[model samples]
Target chain A: MNEKAYFSEQIRLYEQNIYGLALSILKNEHDAADVMQDAILKAYSSLHTLRDRRKFKSWILSIVHNTAIEHLRRQKPTIDIDEQYDLAAPEPTVDPETRHTVRAAIEQLSLAHREVIVLYYYENYSTGQIAEILDLPPATVRQQLFRARKALSKHLNKEDFDR
Target chain B: MTTPSDRDIRRQLEAEGRPAVPDFVHQMTEATLAALPEKLPVQRRPSPFKRISAAAACAALLMLGVLPNVSPAYAQAAGRIPLLGSLIRVLTIRNYTYDDGSHLLEADIPHVEDDDNAEAAALINADIDALTNAAVSRFYHELELSGQGYGSIHIDYETVTATDRWFTLQLRVTETAASSTTYLKYYHIDRQTGRHVGFGDLFAPDSFAALEAAIRAEMQAQMDADPQIDYYIEDEQPDGAPTTLSADQPFFFTENGDLVIVYDKYTIAPGSMGNPAFTIPKSVYEPLLK
Candidate 1:
């Protein structure tokens, strides 16, 4: 396939992965969506630098990680009145009454913990690969993952009494 | 209440990501694809060998003694005493330079002078004229497009290999607009045969496939060895990526008689990989050589 076709295929295949990654970092769906657009376009423009097409998933995710962080940094001190609503936690898709599903548990974790968990579990990236994508030391990623799992277990154990 | 294991957590997360992407994101993806040019712009890569053979400009010439003093009186008297016999010389016959701030052009046109081999000289000269002229014409065309200058094409030549049996001339052309791109063309002549030799000429008709496969293997090996190195091996680029060598593929025989296959900058790899060349030992392809 031509580069454009290949790139289009990859984007479609990984769009959800891209969105999840950005959402985990930004926690604001609108901002995450914007960041996703920025990162994908950035990856497309710089695709020539990637030596191996197989590494494209990780490479693009790394770009998304960096772009989301930058967006977080540039956000204004005072949220716009309309945007403040988006900043609030997104409503849970399932287990509406409990509000303690694994998805909700993941949303409650710190950004650092959330990022590692998504990369490790959702993307199936190795610890070393996660460190590379997040630009964190491997030790930090391991520590964050360890702590995140502990917190998640704790969060999930306090399950729905409504069940 | 039971806590979830890592696998359970992963499954749930995967489930969360499974819903269809938002309509807005699909639109954005479409828009991004639309924004891209129909053809991906091949990034201009710097030639890796450029540092080794810098074409230092010698815009003018002053060679009085070496060349046949083709003075009108001398020409009339002897008719033609074609200089030192069989001596090979390359001199900058003309230098075209124009720089009005934005648009600049530097063309150091060279002539291959071989007194005993005028045929070879004429062949090389004609080809060089065509290349430089095309480059110059494009430079003017682009210049006229914008009232302000866009870029320049600097054409220069370097003799990469010159031996009693073989002579290889490498012409490097660099064109720059918003960015710069550089490509190379090599011309080789077999002194013994009094004829030009190239990728196809040196190989048997049936050897083309083997030669292409060998070059492709080298490309894969290079990328495997160095993660930073990349070739458009199977980028499915209908045009730029090569599954076959050009009839006059840029190549030269080393003094050691090793056959080197060369692709111009941005030919097989991006501009950053520069001009890629692989040297195959003479023995490997000895049977294939004509």
Candidate 2:
């Protein structure tokens, strides 16, 4: 296939993953859409830079990761400290209602924590893959997953009190 | 109710639905393809003197209204001809205007493709796009929160050198809000191999100490020669001098191939001093060149 055709096929196959990754990071559908478009154009324009075709999935996702983070950083000057809580809190009860609570809790996570969790659990990316896409150390990705899970549990448990 | 185990949480997360891709993806793909240059235009090869004279003539004609009647396409094609083509070409890829009229973003992004250095060109383009996007987005976000000011961001690029052996492109970004500041970034490519060059790549690996010493000595002499000139002095300065230079510090080569070390505002001096740059002649470090 020609270059444009190849780029289009690759983008078509990965569009959902790219959108999901952006939404996970930005936590806003509109911003996520904007990031997805920007990332696609950028990837298409620079496809020749891909040295290893085997790593195409990670390469495209890395663009989405950077674009989303850039969008988030532009949206706010300071991080919301409230999004980060103590990770040693007790786990919440796993009732059917916990399923409803999970998404909301995920939205409350800091951008860094939410990214690893979504890439790992939702996208089924390994820690190594997530680290590569996010340009972070694998050890750091694992640590983020641990803290993110704890934070989610704490948020879900706190929701029970509001009820 | 029992507490949720990590396994349970993981299962639920996996089961959660992802956001749907928007309809705009196809539109964006089409737009991108349409914008892609189908074939690389033949480079306008002209002697240095002729190129300058032609550029000057074009500018003169443009100012005289003689070129105004020409169609844009015709003008563009004419401009790309060997005698009329510009030394550097910059094109606007994207622009953003806020609904509230509080801010504007204009990106005159660069791309290098269809050349011997296509891969290097792609890398340079990607880096520039990332930087420009991040800066514009940050400014946009700030404007959204403040909701009371006017601001503009512009990113433009220039070709510092475009020879067969070496290609250097420089990006100048100006962001204006309550205040304005311009940041400079450069991309240097070894055109033959399509490899990006960093500050350390220009010198021998083991010659960092000599470079640092030379730079420090030059900086000191410059300060001594002019009382108005000053660099940041570390509080612990045994000799009241700046710290040692890092290999990764920002630098670029002059037309004469001299090295100019650049420090961002407040990096080596106070913000009022702006970005301070010192040129070290090639003679100073000729032995260090790789």
Candidate 3:
């Protein structure tokens, strides 16, 4: 296949993964759309720069990750530490009624923790793959995964009670 | 009340439907695909030994004083040899490419070394190489720190004018991070004295004010004549008056000898304006030319 056709097919194959990753990082549907658009355009323009065709999936995911982070940085220059640490105290509760609540709780986690959880649990990427995509150390990814699970559990428990 | 188990969380996450690709994304991708060039840029990989041989041959020819008697076709043929094929007069000496998956650099660089203007040529070539190398190293350094996405730097050049008396080279260095940004630089050489020239060398001393005024008037007049052509004068100066061109402002001479002033993106207008350039007729600056 031609370069454009190949690129288009790659985009089609990974469109859902790209969008899901962007949405997980950005936590807003509209922002995720914008990031996806920007990342796709960027990937298309610089396709020649991709030396390894085998790593195309991870390569594009890295672009999306960076683009979303850049967008978030531009939107809010300074992140709130208190907001990240304000995890709800976990309480024993029955399983939630809908997956929507769990997804919403995931979105409530800080950008750093949320991304690791989504990549690990949702995308099923290994810690090494997540670390590579996020440009974090494996140790950091594991720590993030640990913290993210706690935050999610607490947030879901609280979310269930609030509902 | 009990917290959900990791298995339950994973199941719930898996159950979460994949976000649908927005309709606009598909439309935008299609539009982008349609807009892309039919052929991807050809990656030229000229071997180093061949380049050295070509340069040695050219230098030997120059030392033998054979270039003057040689046919233009022979001169042109020399350029088609290998690496430095185009470097004899106004050609790219090296179009370097480096891609290690994470970082990529492509530079179309010039190498000019006239027997008469050897010093000036060497200085200009060194300067260009230094700039390109610095940009490459900086990009690599940045990528090393933030290895999130691919980083690239492209350095392409255009020979604006190549006359016996004057030679002007325009270099565009585009560095891509999340988005691509381009910076423009111009190199001018006085072939006779073998001296690198800048804005100051082009005109008579004390003639800068008149030249600036003339350029501003011409740009403003052009903007007034064409609705599609709007400069950033209004955005730059709230009063909407043309700002005086700086003495060291970037510029080049067209083959017709007209002065073309170039502004980097976001300097005079929004990036949509994209490196705005205004050409002033030769007649306007005739008296000012040194």
Better of 1 and 3 by lDDT: 1
Docking class of 2: incorrect
lDDT of 3 by residue, B1-290 (tens): 25566777766655665567778766765675566555543221211111123343344334324322212122232232222234336556655566766567776666665566677878777667656545544454454434445568887777777765667777788876654557787887876677887776676557767776765676689667875444544344212324556555678887677888876553444333466777768888887777
Candidate No. with top lDDT: 1
Q: What does DockQ come to for candidate 2?
A: 0.11
A best-first ranking of the candidates according to their lDDT comes to: 1, 3, 2
**TM-scores of chain A across candidates:** 0.81, 0.79, 0.80
lDDT of 3 at A69: 74
User: Model 1: how far is A32 from its true place, Å?
Assistant: 23
Pull out the clashing pairs in model 1: B45-B271
Candidate DockQ scores, in order:
0.13, 0.11, 0.12
For model 2 the local lDDT of residue A48 reads 46
lDDT of 1: 0.65
Docking class of 3: incorrect
lDDT of 2 by residue, A58-97 (tens): 7788878766665665677495433432233344444545
Candidate 1 lDDT over A1-163, as tens digits, reads 8887888888878888888888888878788877876776556545554556777787788878877765665675454423431232333234433446566677787667778888988788877667656645455567778877776765564343223
Give the chain B TM-score for each candidate.
0.68, 0.59, 0.61
